[model samples]
Target: MNKHFYQKCIASALALIMFFSLFAGANPAKAEAALNINADGAILVDGETGKVLYEKNADSVLGIASMTKMMTEYILLDAVKKGKVKWDQEYTPSDLVYKISQNRDLSNVPLRADGKYNVRELYDAMAIYSANAATIAIAEIIGGSETNFVKMMNEKAGKLGLKDFKFVNSSGLNNRDYKGEQPQGTGAEDENVMSARAVAKLAFHLINDFPDVLKTASTPKKTFREGTEDRIEMINWNWMLPELDYGYQGMDGLKTGTTDFAGYCFTGTAGRDGKRFITVVQNAKDSSGKGGYKARFDETRKMMDYAFSNYSKEKIVPKHYQVKGQKTIPVIKGKENEVKIYTKSAINMIVHNGDEKNYQPVLVLDKKKINKDGKLTAPIKKGEKVGYVTVKPKNGEKVSFLTGEDQIQVDVIAAQDVEKANWFVLMMRGVGNFFGDVWHGIASTVKGWFK
Candidate 1:
């Protein structure tokens, strides 16, 4: 064929290939429903990445019942860490604590108005038994009074970026006088309200910040105020604990909630093979036509089982993983003209079963950060972010197959320190590079002329 004809044919073939490549890679896969949980609101999140695996009415705010104590726990634990309260720090309960303790209608750890209990005892009562009076006493100690404590709780909720959440009391117990920041009366109507998403976020924050809470919460049963006359037995209400009938392996301690208005609710967490999951269910009902806590545990088990059975932790980008095929980045005024780079931390992802083999992540580097000359300023500090690697679906259709469409951006940083170049080193390198560039240019020109 003539040269012109040959070139035209090649162009036509390349155009056809390009068209098919774009068409095949542009379609996004639709995410299918994995689990159908029975609840008014629910959420499941990957513990390590905070990725939402499943959610239904997760943003609808309603009364959270005793689960509000999770916030109480977060605040109390934070106080301890900040030296605001000691494990042995004692607090004097007011008449209100005694009233709540004696009110049989509510859950309480018997409190003596004149008696002083340490922070640790109160925390145990609240975490294990969901004692309303103990929660109040601790809140009072933390914020000087119940009203002030509620304010602190709300403040914390705000800091956690929780939306559609309101704290009327430190304890989740209903107060008739409080409603969404407005107190009407002293009846059993006022209660702290939050959405499943907000609760899940709070739970994530709790475990991420104060992991010690799990130690107390995981205990199926323990004695509060041990070795003292005031000591009382505390039983964990979370039936998902391994010792319970509905228990499963790896299931640890979390919080549970129950009330006429809130029905049965639970925030559960479990770990296996270094992968952890957190699930929250609200207003769940039982299969036996009962409207009690059974449904909460039953539904929680289903969600937990589905997650544990289907998902796994995969290290997509391992720490110190060299960027394959990446040209060495040129360093300006450094001891060397170029430097090698590697990932600072591993990029792990929670993927469903079968997906570990199918889902492939593409590393997208910032074009601006990579210049044509591949040059970078020297004095690079180790772990200092230099660019970003966006982890996206290798196949566009896989976008829908994943939990979220948004790409995970990992900061690509310098793996090691690159010291500034001395003046003598710079001068020597510059002369060497200039000659190298000239030699390469002449060699390339001569080679092209021959071709």
Candidate 2:
């Protein structure tokens, strides 16, 4: 080949390779395989930040089964904390609780017709054993009746920012299980329902707002009415407990649910190496399409494994970090024309490995503190919060927090003080601006004439 031809060929080949490399970089290989979660609905979230790490059909409302009790637990705990109810206060079993507690078909710790169980005892049975009757007794103590408790559940769900949920009863049982004696405000066939996202949110708040609940939830075995003739062994249904046959390390205080309608469902939380995750699996099944206790835990384990192996809590945006082109805001009538601003705290979020660069910070200033042009008034104090900063994916991938409203955020504050200019200085500046505007107008007119 001629020398010139050889040179041209080499350049063409180089160009082709560069083009392909750019194309490949633009559309990088998929980071990892989609999690193989076997469930109708599922979600995995960082326990600390509520950042959703993985999800499948998480918004579709489905039967929550006994997971509904987490809400009841939240309310009861709040009541106890606020002095609305006492742990030592005793509750007399009503006819409904008495009858339901005796039913062997349901998960119950058989209550005596004349029994006066304390709130603490009933709470243990409900939290550890998923005792339906015990749950109802606690609900009655708080809401005065199961019907009222259902209202409280829905109300609290709204306040907690849970989007998809319906509470027909304090216990998660289908209303039909009530045998026509269901709570008054619900339909005969209605069952407690919530989306996987909402379930995870509930679990998140349950553990965070009331960490003590885990102590009771982790109990594998407790005797109801211990030392009494009516005492019965209550074994926790959560097989993932560290003491159980299918135990997983770091597993603690969570709930499990199963029903013909809801199949097998679980809301599980585990922590390892200072990182914790909350996972929810609804209608979980095995390879053979079989739903069982083990199936729920298996599916949950899959998600948990995917999270711990592939993701980590990273300080995506460091404290005092300033956003480009937004590091300062113009100050009106100040010693300095502008004030430097930076994040008040670091933004730590759960992120997939290799995806850290995908996120960017967004600044939203407080409207009341700034003018329409985003200029701040004079006399701004150092470290004063002017707005907030939230993180969003640069690639536009949807990022959802456990609570719909809980986007990971930190405060944006002024980095330095901006004192107001003296009145004489302000007056002189105003005169200068007026003259400058007059001169600029005259110059513009002259330029127009030339044009």
Candidate 3:
């Protein structure tokens, strides 16, 4: 048997296997089953891609408590970033804000009526310390009133496309004991409610849009006016930071929330080797009252460990990916012999570890549209979408790299322009191609006779 013939037979067999594999379904290598977390609602997502890695009751609506402050910070920080508010500008806390800060039932930074705090100081206290009074004070400064600020928070939620969330107060605290100027359209019964997924989304936006929030949230401790007669020291409650467990590397800043109604909630973020993840755990019970804080942190750590251990960011089709099999398509009348082609945009997917090799990128050319007899008629424009490169798993649809549901199909496009060929050139090429085909047919017939 001829070596070429043997190779061809093997190639054909492989193609058939692939064709059936598409319909037969893939058995992607499985990771260890996701760990069961002790939380009423939870989610873990890739920070860069917004890919959900783990979720349990993530969409269940419940009181979000101080997680509400993530929104308030988003709104207020956006205002500050937009020059609508100034960091150095001082604002006197209202009687209501002073009262809330002083309330023993809630977490606060102890703001006094006589103490003049700047916008930056107030924001730090609210973000790092979860100060209800400071949050409300910032709201009044930015939104002109607490009620209007609540409206702004809801509006921002709507803009973010949050499905299961509502904000009734700037702070996540319950409103029963609070007697201040309520926003005009608000009532005491209203409280901030959202799902774990919604809170994750909010965290995503906060870190994505305003990375500076991470800087403030990650600091374990900071003194606003150090060595001063009126200095105030603030400490971050997020224990995932390096100061606590330096081995829990890349653990950075994010907010922690807890209340009688919301339980213990945390929106945690961490990065390692350029990969970052955002995790949310809401309504985690303190099985033992002493371990309440540790419960939520442990749950977050479990999810993050699962994610970092099992998953990685992979490029589905790279930005500079050149079409492998066919770089150029033959042209009938174009001055150039062929026009180069490529995909329009880069595609990325979060693939489980060790499954990268299973992804197979198959090029499906538009034969009917582009070429009937191995020649495409020109004038071909640059960047014209021509075909598709489908990235499928070797086993099938069941184990596809993209979220394990859909195969990633990327558009194949023309890379450059091809001008029309002149009449003489077209006639000459036509004659050459005709004779070439006849010679090839005769050669094939001769080979077949020997076989």
Best by TM-score: 2
- For 1-451, candidate 2 gives per-residue lDDT tens digits of 8999999999999999999654332311132245677899988888987877777888999998888889999999999999999999998899999999999899999888987889999999998899999999998999998999889999999999999888899999988888999999789999999999899999999999999999999998998888989889989989899899789889996999877889899999999977899999999999899898889989888877777887767888999989989999999999999999999989887777667777889988999999988899999999999999888778666776675534788999999889999999999999999999999999999999988
Q: Where is model 2 more than 4 Å wrong at Cα?
A: 1-33, 446-451
Candidate 1 whole-model C-alpha lDDT, 0 to 1: 0.76
**Candidate 2 similarity to native, TM-score:** 0.90
lDDT of 3 by residue, 23-53 (tens): 3332322222447778888888878756666
Which consecutive 10 residues in model 2 have the weakest lDDT in total? Answer: 23-32
- All candidates: CA RMSD in angstroms? 8.5, 4.1, 9.5
Better of 1 and 3 by lDDT: 3
- Say which candidate scores most in lDDT: 2
lDDT of 2: 0.87
Q: Arrange candidates by TM-score, highest first: which order?
A: 2, 1, 3
After superposition, candidate 3 runs with Cα above 4 Å error:
1-33, 227-230, 245-247, 286-291, 322-339, 344-348, 358-414, 418-451
The lDDT for every candidate, in the order shown, is 0.76, 0.87, 0.79
